[model samples]
Target: MFAGAQVSLYPMADGFVGVILESLSALDPYRDQLRIETDDISTLIVGPPEVLFPALRDLYCAASASGHHLVLRTTLSRGCPGEPDDPICDTSCLANPSEPLAQRQANALETLRLAPDMGQVADAQFSLYVMGNGDHMAEIMGCIDFLKQSGTFYKSKHFCTRLTGDAGAVFATLQQAFCQFGPANGHVTIDLTVSANSPSKR
Candidate 1:
């Protein structure tokens, strides 16, 4: 029951320090919501998906707005097997003292709502490994259908489906799939990977 990501941000421009610093600064507001660690190579963020995705959305949007070439690559996962238990694994945030499921879905939906139609901005891709369901195949297919209709998913793969179109729509579709099919009992898990690159200014 753990969710985390390792991210590398590359801003392609002369003396890119300002852009990099600006992007890192964007995470400051999200510090309380995420478990963040940065070093020489990349930054690591760990927390609930409800909190993590929006932080990514805001951070990336701000970074890409620099009018400089930038690439943000990430590996995100939840309920991963053999991942050691940590504070980020806490389930307390999944539910409220009151109507837990409703609140959880609402929080998850917020992430999707923040997604921007990156179609005019960037072309990106992400992968999801949806796990732990008896009717998983049907649910998975439904998710694929949902993505296809959204015009964000490009093709289906064996282990992961490749996504396309606007970065925001792609992310929105991904989050929507997880929120709709993700387990309510905490028995299911999903592993995700995202790459935001290739400016659509083509």
Candidate 2:
């Protein structure tokens, strides 16, 4: 049940160092709940999805509040076969493997509806990977359907889906995509990039 994320933040501003350091404060509240370590490249946050996603949302919103173009790149994973199980990652939130896909999608949408509004807009593109055996595409397609129904959905793109809205809903959608659809104890991962205050808008 090990789960975590490797996150790197890029701020398009002259005071990038300050922005980065300041944004990190957003994770203070989650420090006791997560094992976080930062080096030159990225920060690794080890925790359950329940705490992981909100920590990410707050961190991103803090950076976005600087009014500078900001980009957050994260690689999130749960139940990786190669990783050792950790007690810190324990949680009851993952969808049951036997749960019907339609039911899972319904639950995901309901969760999104209750996501908090962070007052910051985010545009994100990501790909969900449900690793290991079983009908992978079916699970992926079911997640895609959930995303389309998610209010944050922006559009579909090559190799990934785009989502736009309040940072809360967007991150919640990403969390659902990671938590639902796949086997409860199976390996699942997400490659995600979220942007805010970008100068160019298509």
Q: Pick the candidate with the highest TM-score.
A: 2
- CA lDDT of every candidate: 0.63, 0.94
- After superposition on all CA atoms, what RMSD does each candidate show versus the true structure? 5.2, 0.9
Tens digit per residue, CA lDDT, model 2, 1-202: 8999999999999999999999999999999999999999999999999999999999999999999998999999999988999999999889988889999999999998889988899999999998899999999999999999998888999999999999999999999999987898899999999999988973
In angstroms, how far off is 99's CA in candidate 2? 0.9
lDDT per residue as tens, model 1, 60-82: 77777787777777776666666
Q: After superposition, how far is residue 158 of candidate 1 from its true place, in Å?
A: 8.8
The residue ranges of model 2 lying beyond 4 angstroms of the native Cα positions read: none
Give the Å shift of residue 46 in candidate 2: 0.4
Regions of model 1 farther than 4 Å from truth:
87-120, 131-139, 154-168, 182-201
What are the clash counts of all predictions, listed in order?
A: 1, 0
